[model samples]
Target: MAHPSFSLSRRLRLSLVSLSLLACGAAWAQQAPSSATAPAPTPSGHMLAEIQVIPRPAGTADDRYKHVDAAIAVIQASGLRYEVHGLGTVVEGPPEKVWPLLQAVHQATLEAGAERTLSIIKVSSGAQAGGPRVEDLVRKFRN
Candidate 1:
């Protein structure tokens, strides 16, 4: 007759080994290097958002100027980036604050004659070596 305790011990050992292997595989998968197209990190250690407004009817030179100026004013007033053409804007702060700001900007741009609004969430490169940083604009404007 086999010992019941021995059987139980064997089962427990097998379970532990199986669990460890699964855990290791998961960790390895997560640690693998991501492709360039992989998602970027947000400014708040979360996902980032990029908003772009393309003018509707493709306004004239003066119209373009006015539209951009109005949008810029709103962005400046909101204390966000006026330009996010490159690595994109970096809005770092609490989500509570950032969420509202993003929403407000979205609404405001749409109202400013934008045919469509493009919003992207990704990581900020934060300027680059020997290049301008997102903070530069703030410093330049002294805001």
Candidate 2:
């Protein structure tokens, strides 16, 4: 017979593995390609993602700005539509494209001499045909 503690630990491990698999499956489902031949659909609607990258550099404040500028350069080159705000940048695209671009942005910050980095991200997905756009959301409140 197994020890009680060992049995409980085994159950916990199994539970964690199950949860991890379920999470991965759900994520894959969202970005899965419609067919084997064609690439994943850009999903007619839009998805909005906001990302803020904070880089901790060893030098002065200017060093931090340098990292941010590097990240912005990556975003500019990504070709996904984006708007830069005071605190963060908002990007609009399908999940398949936006996710990879965000990753690239983070990596660019690190390559720009940041010893450590923190990335805060927010994502909103819409089911509507055109999806939600940044302009539309702010237009209603503007004077």
Which candidate gets the maximum lDDT versus the true structure?
2
Off by over 4 Å in 1: 1-49, 57-61, 80-88, 123-143
TM-score of candidate 1 to 2 decimals: 0.39
Q: Which has the greatest TM-score?
A: 2
Output the lDDT of residue 143, model 1. Answer: 30
Candidate 1 on 1-143: residue-level lDDT in tens? 65775477544432221122222234434553447443333343322234443333223456633443454455567654434442233454444555776667556656777666444443233242222223332332333
Cα deviation of 103, candidate 2, in Å: 0.6
Instruction: Give the clash count for each candidate.
Output: 4, 0
Compute the lDDT of residue 102 as modeled in candidate 1: 62
Instruction: Mark the regions of model 2 whose C-alpha exceeds 4 Å error after superposition.
Output: 1-45, 58-64, 127-129
Kindly list the per-residue Cα lDDT of model 2 for residues 1-143, writing each as its tens digit: 76675567544432221122222234444543335444334457568788777766522465537787888889899888888775678888878899898899888888988888777777777666545456544433347
